[model samples]
Target chain A: MNAITARLSSFRRHLDPAVITAFACILLLLFLGSLYSRNFLSPEYLLQQLKVASFLGIIATGMMLVILLGQIDLSLPWVVTVGAMMSSAAAGFGHTGAMLAIPFGIFCGVLIGLVNGFGVAYLRIPSMIITLATNAVAQGLMVVYTGGFSPQDSASPTMRYLATGFIIPSIPNSVLCWIIVGAAAVFLMNRTGFGRSIYGIGNRERAAYLSGINTRRIVLTVFGISGGLAAFGGVLLAGYASKAAQSMGDAYLLPAIAAVVLGGTSILGGRGSYLGTVAGVLLITLLQSILSVMQMPEFGRQIIYGLVIIMMLLLYGRESLSR
Target chain B: MKQWRFWFVEHRGTLMALVIFVVMFLIYASNHPAGFGANMVQTASNKGVLLAFVAMAQSLVVITSGIDLSVGMVFTLTNCLASWLVVGSPAQVILGIIAVLAVGAVCGAINGCVVIYGRLQPIVATIATGAIYYGIALALRPFPGGTVNETIADALTGKLFNFIPASLVAMIAIVFVVWVPFSRSVAGRAAYAVGSSETAAYMSGVPIKRAKFFAYTLSGLLAGTGGLFLTFFTYTGEAAYASGNAYTLFSIASVVLGGVSLMGGKGSAIGAIFGALAFRTIGDLLFVFDFDPLWQPLFQGVVLLLAVSLSAFGLLRVRNRLDWFT
Candidate 1:
């Protein structure tokens, strides 16, 4: 009996309790959703949810990287909008524009991210404020570009195929994109020097700099990469919806932050995993779906969402945040 | 001369914000078709005061080395509540105003409790609370239609006897009534101490938790005032998600431009007020310049980026690279 108890303790030691809790919540949410509707447990619906989650999953991936570096990108909403709007806008030029739409949108996002990094790293400004300013700028630029009207250009065929098509007979293309991105993120965070540097900088930038890490450059690059991923998410969103719309990204900002935090990524930075973020993404998507299925009013859903996040934070995240 | 220099250094941020606003306002006035008449000033003040109150609310929390994302939501929530209650007879309207402010205080207290007692980060805690506040706001006025007492609205939003904006007067009075007293109080000093260094402050037996709680509570009251004024401005209530978010962001910008360091323990609400006025002027400048209103956001962004970047110049003076993090 003692041997079994010791083995259990060892197993618990290897796992993050927050991640486990998040996964458990996801299951609990699934169960709750099934109680609301029998079809909730069905394969097609679950796959559909996964496809939908991939959008947030992608954006949250970028957010996680920034958060790991102990910086935030409040400019995310507009970055996503810029990506979708610019990519779709590019479709107006011709076949080449359509072909380059995806890359173009992602490029626009990366530009914004690089700017965020520059402001945070080189300028030594707080990440929150810099990202906020950039977000306003992006919003302004988009407003001017679209003339306050919704852009007329629709997603290209390739964009559509990438977003909603079945690339592997049964699996979604977007899910596959998420898998590819997630795999890369896992490898980057767990297996790369860059990842270690991010953690190091997040832990203590002064120490990282003293140790010869080019902290500013790493910051800029992480922000840039985060932007690219967010824009890529936008491209997928524009494709799924068939057109880019103004303020489409507005709905995403809090959710992405909440998902990352919920997944046990420290809001203070330096300690989180890609797998935890993945779990967080699914949990948020599921919670979102369940609330909607329960026919809860939008405001009610928001209240519940906020309350739950706070409750969870109180439960587990209270201690790690102080440092 | 040394004494004078110290005085200048102390007020540098506030004076800079004042100068920026003055210069921008002058430019805006000179180019205006109306040429800066009482009516125009009244209009500008009415618009500017809303942000000023919110900025002041933000500055309080920031001075305590914390951020409150819910001020805008509190502003919205109060606006919605005011629409419902700040109507009918004078007695009823007064009661309604009190209730609105009280609710705002409650919201802020909740934020304080979460951050201080619950041991959560201010940013995340406020964001969550902000969501909840916004949800309540949306629930309060699901539709964008409600009524505020027209008499009170007109009186507050309009100019006093043709020259001074009443909204401006109210703001000043509150600054004197609320800010002066708070800044001189032990709690306020504790807030500064905590912001500068929580550990040191605690070791010195400063009232760290109480100071933060005070800052958060007062912040809510200020935001509530902004919301109450919003109802006065529009004479209607709307649960606008974007506008709420925008106000929150703009308040932060105003705080920064006012020279209140996000790093905490510096700057003043007076500077933040001037910063807000200047920020508002940025939007108005485009109008006088004949630029499309569409250009406002882009123009605002460029100006803010430049302004924030100017503060980064100090980094060049650092001899040790490690000092940048601290």
Candidate 2:
């Protein structure tokens, strides 16, 4: 009893309870998964899983920034699609186009993000509605750009190389990309004034304003980063598939939100850690892998996914509500 | 004169929606080759009423300052269920309709219980439940093939007379049946009170839980009505995930267009119905003017942004920057 008490105290001092719980869930899932399939815990399989998780991790990091501000960007689906489609379309041109493909895709996302920021920060439209409207507009434009048909444009060689290629032996470039982004996110959230301002604004806009933070600019920059990250994730997806399909980003929205929340980040904002989000990304990716390994049908998978999220929310969100 | 102004203030949202719908429909009808004929009206009503029902469902929850993202999934689930149950003999059809509606209420009640009793935020709770409901729907109709009773479907969908669409009359009847009674009931008034100010409402001895439960259950029933009509119009049940999401989204837009406040405690379902009508007219307006069908989503988004901006102009009037926090 003494040991347990001491351990929990140290744990509380060093790590968030929600983060610990999530890591515990990840470990528990692994133990159970290995019991079901002997190869589930194998290093090769785990490494492969990390490679897949990189995509969602990239997007979730961006989502985290916005969620930390107590705002949401529902426009992720179309922004992602726009990124993939536009980048691929750009790559359809000559050598110059191929070179600029990646940045161009991300830039498209930034543009939408700015619009989202303008609506939310300046216009004071609720983030949910403004993002939703932009999502629709993006979707429509993409459809018209491709004339409601699947694009003939395929991902460039450089794009393909970035996703499937590895610089160091045994580590995927995609994972490296995720690490770079995650590190940047950590630094921003911990070391930067902008990141601190996000927490302040999220806690209470009036308080933050009184404290002299430029809340609107922060909102715009955060949304812009989110858009760029979503597009980057899309670029990775395009590379993996070697092309983009219609509405490919549709499947990412809920999972991204679920991952961020699962990581113990408050959906209402103002409280969370980047490491928690990382754990969340890993947990979600692993659960999905294990479920698919079990051959659970799509509908069944969906049901379990929803149930798990609710269970997690019930565990943590209850405290926030009561206060 | 003072009483009249007060009444107008109370009904302004609905009135605004009515005017918007009137103007849009007029433009659509004038531009159409069919020239606002009975056939044209029937076709328009058939499409418009589905959204109207969903928007009404949304309005019920929005009035209480809670959102039900699962409303669309309830719609899809009930539609899938209706396809399985709303076929066969007359007795079976009635039973099936009741079952579908019951399931919708159950789904909604689950959402309410999570939000109210479990103390989960409404947005996350409904998103979670929405996924579950959608999963059930997918399991029921994996391939999107189910049948509905053609006779009953035709009666509901067809024209009441040579000049009047049956769907429009039924929508009005539903307005009388659902919205009127709820707005008059104690629970309904409690809902409004809670929405306006929950802490104050609770202090005043309003039955907050009961009011919420009533609102959520009715919201489900209304969405179920939409599902039933969907089965009628399509005459088949397919678990179209995109369509469910679209309906959920569009209903919110319609609610906003109808002058229903996303902030809660304001607006009327009557206005949401017209809002639905106006939103539907966007597509028709495009078709009448020979724009590509692909342009529809962009057009809808632009119009919505403009409307939302018009509303946001209210923010400009605030001299105190802190008021923006509210």
DockQ of every candidate? 0.67, 0.65
lDDT of 1 at B261: 82
| Candidate 1 wrongly placed segments (more than 4 Å) | A1-12, A320-323
Against the unseen true structure, what C-alpha lDDT does each candidate score? 0.91, 0.90
Error of 1 at A16 (Å): 0.8
Among all windows of ten consecutive residues in candidate 2 chain B, which has the lowest summed lDDT? B304-313
Residue A68 lDDT in candidate 2: 95
- Give model 1's docking category: medium
lDDT of 2 by residue, B1-326 (tens): 99999999999999999999999999999999878799999999999999999999999999999888888888998999999999999999999988988888888788888888888778788888999989899999999798999999999999886778888888899889888999999999999998999889988999999999989888998999899899999998888889998998888889999998887899989988988999999756889998888887788888877877777888879999999987
| Model 2: how far residue A216 lies from native, Å | 1.0
Instruction: State the lDDT of candidate 2 residue by residue for A238-257, as single tens digits.
Output: 99899999999988888898
Please give the range of 10 consecutive residues that has the lowest summed lDDT in model 1 chain A. Answer: A314-323
